[model samples]
Target: MGRRLRRAGRRAPAVAANADGRLEVFALAPGGSALHHRWQEAPGGAWAAAWQPFGTAAGGAPRVVRDGSGRLTVAAPAPSGVAVFHRRQTVPSGGWGEWQHLFGWSDAAPALAPSADGRLEAFALSPGGARLVHRWYADPAGTWAAAREFGEPGAPLAATPTAAADATGRIHVFAVTADGRIRTRVQERPSGGSGPWNAFGERLVAPLPAGTPAC
Candidate 1:
């Protein structure tokens, strides 16, 4: 069974269900300057009222995903473009860690997906949305590896990047190329490392005007 959940004021919500079946939704707060969250206590319970997750203002859409162990991690564009801030819920019972910074310059919101080995991988558009950048940690609590850009530098981005992990643990990133075609990059490793990016070369939609692209 399912129903449309409602919050009086939220935008670009990112949802993830915990191992115990509770649904957690993170969104840009009403003011559009902070992160707000709501969650289900059980399968059919009423959604909680929006509340700030970490008292931090968010500059872009928030992304949330659950790792293999059911821990929840969230990433959003910081009000400052110099970094992205993330918070992790270490336990299902609700002990969330303090917000941590991942330094990288992103002009668009970020995406998060759990790797096959239970770690988390993050993707975002570079400054001016002209490049795709990604990074991941060895584990939820481990050190983060270096950030790497995909595709050729200066390649124009037609939209914000989205990512997903298949059953086999391969991570795939999808985005609109400057020519209005869809493109993808695959991460060969299950632990969040990416392989070469591959483009579909087929125009999926009309190209947007440069500098005003949609994700």
Candidate 2:
């Protein structure tokens, strides 16, 4: 039978498995006051006794992804919504570092996906929701590339984006347009660069609320 894992806030939790294969969950506290975390005591085993505070003053649900080196990193928007912050495990399946400012002026929480080359890439909606912007780690040293606009110039996104890496290592991003249509873009070559935005070819009966998962 299923058992209660832990009490969580209204925002949906984000989960990822560590290099050692243990599953970890990140959730926002009620009212997005803080980001909380818990994990299996052992790979696929019992849960941690208590939820630990990962970070405070989270603006939205947390997004987690593993770097090429297998270390897990998490990102979340600041409570004021003007910027995003991130923290990374000092080593794979080890302790985490303090939160540090990652980027700014996001309308919602950012989406994270590992690139084919092992770098972690982040995507966020511009303040007006008219464009998507992204940046990537340049190396394991943690150098970040300058943020750049993504998607077509005239096509405005209506909601936050979500991303995932395919088996072949290409990263695909999906977003909802104002008219309830889904659109997507992908990397031309894994971590090489991006391809043109394309219609996903399905219109929803109604617009998906902001932050809805696209894929």
Candidate 3:
């Protein structure tokens, strides 16, 4: 599992998507290496992040998320690869339940995202390192959609991808390019006939300073 695994001095930032297809940034604990956060469309219909305790996987990557009705869903990833957690509807006891191994482990270290419509989508880089993929299943019992590529053929050489969802349910992904450049890409439903997936493109996510000192 390739977790965010930030380099010694580099802090891996949390990422999430917005309806405008924009990726938003969050503050990190000083000297902290990894970040885990959830993307939810707030009451006014804006993207907001719910950050999990730094370095704590107790309730899994995201301790909470927004359900379709905007109710908070607290779920956790289990060792058995199931998604399980306690919510207001959990049954008897203190709002907890048996662990459910939703999606088995991906060596790439999986990240969970709640889409605009409230469906949970998980993205992981191929264990063997070939493609960046996204898989979605409605609820715990929902069938998983086939894996979708999040980026072009090139691998994220230096930086890892942090995922996010927008108010419209579109997905935005951010990653550090091979040359240390920040790059972002998004997936969009075809605006017209379904000839092919011609609705995607890549652009500089965070452009580097335009001027530089001569070596």
Identify the leading candidate in terms of TM-score.
2
The clash tally of candidate 3 reads: 15
Give lDDT tens digits, candidate 3, residues 25-133.
3323433333344334442365444544433233223333333433333333332323232222143111223334443433323445556555656555433334455
lDDT of 2 at 59: 74
lDDT of each: 0.67, 0.80, 0.40
- Which scores higher on lDDT, 1 or 3? 1
Output the worst ten-in-a-row residue range by lDDT, candidate 2: 1-10
TM-score of 2: 0.90
Q: Against the hidden true structure, what lDDT does model 3 obtain?
A: 0.40
Candidate 2: residue 85 lDDT (0-100): 88
Give the per-residue lDDT of model 1 (tens digit) for 85-119: 77888685486888887647774457777788777
> Which pairs in model 1 have colliding backbones?
none
In the range 19-114, model 2's lDDT, one tens digit per residue, is 999999988777676778899989989999888878887777788889888999998888887888899999999999888878788736688888
Candidate 2: the clashing residue pairs are none
RMSD of each: 4.2, 2.9, 10.6
TM-score to true structure, per model: 0.82, 0.90, 0.44
Which parts of model 1 have CA positions greater than 4 angstroms off? 1-10, 49-53, 207-215
lDDT of 1 at 55: 49
